[model samples]
Target: MTGEPVLLTCDSGGVRTLVLNRPHRRNALDAELWEALRSALVDAGADRSVRALVLTGAGDAFCSGADLPKRPSTAHPLHRMRTLTEVTLLLHELPMPTVAKVTGVAVGAGWNLALGCDLVIAVPEARFSQIFARRGLSPDCGGTWILPRLVGLQQAKRLALLAETIDAGEALSRGLVTWVVAAADVDAFTDDVTARLAAGPPVALAQTKALLNENTDRTLREALAGEARAQAVNFATADAPEAYAAFAEKREARFTGRWAVPTRTEDDA
Candidate 1:
């Protein structure tokens, strides 16, 4: 953490929000910001108090992209790419869910960064674009891989090929964002969503996220088997039994065991 902290960090309730603080630059990612973000993400993942994480930016913009002016000055391109790949993996593999709160432009790698999260909530002012082609560069930060998986191949192609910007409503219509709200409602909507996720059964939520990620790469038979195994493990948890009892008693389930991450019986086999 250097250069005036690189980013802003705030923890409220059980949610940790990392806001990209370089508002003057529209939250452009320089090497320092990337490193600081990775460190912050690691710390948040390790903190048991954090039930969910939010990635946003200061000012109106979520992120414009990687710092374009510094690209030519970067000495180790391959190393930087590797670091970014690790960061993406970390976001995907974190035990807690992540939500990207986008109120303004999210372009190039910035768009990819938001895609890396589990969910995205955007305001009416939000804009998404794949600007690599416009810059005479191919997709970086796994944008090519993640975008198609998100909004399908054709839509991804249209955006990446033309480097066109799409507004929030169009993003929602294209399934690019999980939720869309009015510009003024972005903060409230993000807080509400994060609060709901934080209040969920931590163990189950983690398991569900893992299962969804795993199933994305699994065959039908494998997915069914994996679902059964996951269900069996969930059924054995204390929370599961409590849930059943409460349901039978016609009341909300009071799960006292918080943040109980279930061990995976097997890797993605």
Candidate 2:
């Protein structure tokens, strides 16, 4: 609210919520909005206190897509497109968990933005479409990379090629969205999910997210090695000891968000 009219940011209970504020244009991504969004994501990534992020829209629609001018701009198109690419990659690579709360239409780049999140929860009436083809362009915003991974190659092609709008139920069935609930229940559901994520051990959750995100590209041996390394790192964190203590005491573990991986000494070796 303090910055541009395009985005509104709020923090509560270790969760940072970024709401797209352009309601009239259905929260479409303009150049300025894109820059603001990237800045916000970067800040969230750097803030250790921010355990989770939620992306939503201020109005009924999540986002309509890019707000292109009727005539071509003098500015370089690829430069602008690269900005969007940066935003998508930042969101995908951010250490903390991210969730997209979808309500109305999430189309083209907008839909892809939601797909970039670690989890997406939508209302029953929410709609989604890969509408770039209809605009005489192919999908960007990491849509090509994420869609096939989520719904398989054939389905990815069909959805992109057809540019058809599908409701939240179909999106859930196709693995595009993690969950779908009634419009009335979306707020409560999202709150519960994000709260749980926020309370989770930061280092362990981050390590798990990194492992799963990269698992598809690594060999089994490499994955096993990576898992061992991640476990070693986890064991060095204060949360690891807290987890054990809590298990013994039958109480919830308190994580301080401290990530200190101890150095190995000759004695340990």
Candidate 3:
């Protein structure tokens, strides 16, 4: 579409949504769209008000991967790939939880994009593929790293090397998908889930997410120490005390993520 944003963004209930906007080409990642995505992700990561993030595609198909025919030839592949690497790392490192809502095909880099999220939800008819080998390329967008961690080494190899497309059920079986729901209910289900996440204790949830992501590479002792550090930080936040009070009162906790210890404010000065 002429003069349209390559990425569409919206905010609701502390949830930020970033949608790939190139539906006519199955939301392919041209250079423009990649930059758009990176910018949006950076903004989402920096915004403390955003407690959860959702990524999806417009019209149909989550994404078909790079727009090969339109890919820029001016720069070397390595240089061009830095953008993808940054985007992937940003998604992985964002403080809040992230979700991928896959409506249709998510292949190649597109598939890796979804895999980078904390959770993935897809419709029954959705499809996924590593799709790199068939295109005479290796996986990018953190695909190589995330695949084996998600599936086993063998399953990851099969998907990446064979480049075969899989239905949502098989993806679910292989643990690539968190849930597969009816297309009709996916929107409402996603909304409900993200709303719940947005309402969680922001500081604690962010620390928990970071711990889990880093634990795979950590020793038992290191992970325990990390957990201790996270808990110490959480204890300094108002939410932890609020939760304790709510439990004693037999009511729900309203977490504000404010600092529990006294701190100087501009008004105090």
Best-fitting candidate, measured by lDDT? 3
Better of 1 and 3 by TM-score: 3
Candidates sorted on lDDT, descending: 3, 2, 1
- Per-residue CA lDDT of model 3 for 1-269, tens digit only, reads 98999899999999999999999999999989999999998999989999999999998899999889654498887889899999999999999999999999999999999999999999998999989898899999899888999888999899989999999999999899999999999999999999999999999999999999999989999999999999999999999989999999999899888988888899999
TM-score of each: 0.90, 0.94, 0.96
True-vs-predicted CA distance for residue 22, candidate 1, Å:
0.4
- Model 2: residue 11 alpha-carbon error in angstroms: 0.4
lDDT of 2 by residue, 1-269 (tens): 34547889999999999999998889998888999999999999999999999999978999999998778888887877889989999999999999999999999999999999999999988999999989999999999999999999999999999998998889999899999988899989999999999999998899999999999789999999999999998887899889889999999999875766767899999
Residues 57-137 of candidate 1 have per-residue lDDT tens digits of 998899999887633654577876877887788888888889999989999988989988999999887888999998899
Q: Stretches of candidate 3 above 4 Å error?
A: 264-269
Q: What is model 2's C-alpha RMSD?
A: 2.5
Instruction: Enumerate residue pairs that collide in model 1.
Output: none
Flag regions of model 1 displaced more than 4 Å.
1-3, 256-269
Residue 215 accuracy (lDDT) in model 2: 90
Residue pairs with backbone overlap in model 3: none
User: Candidate 2: minimum summed lDDT over ten consecutive residues — where?
Assistant: 1-10
Model 3 TM-score (2 dp): 0.96
Better of 1 and 2 by TM-score: 2
lDDT of each: 0.85, 0.92, 0.94
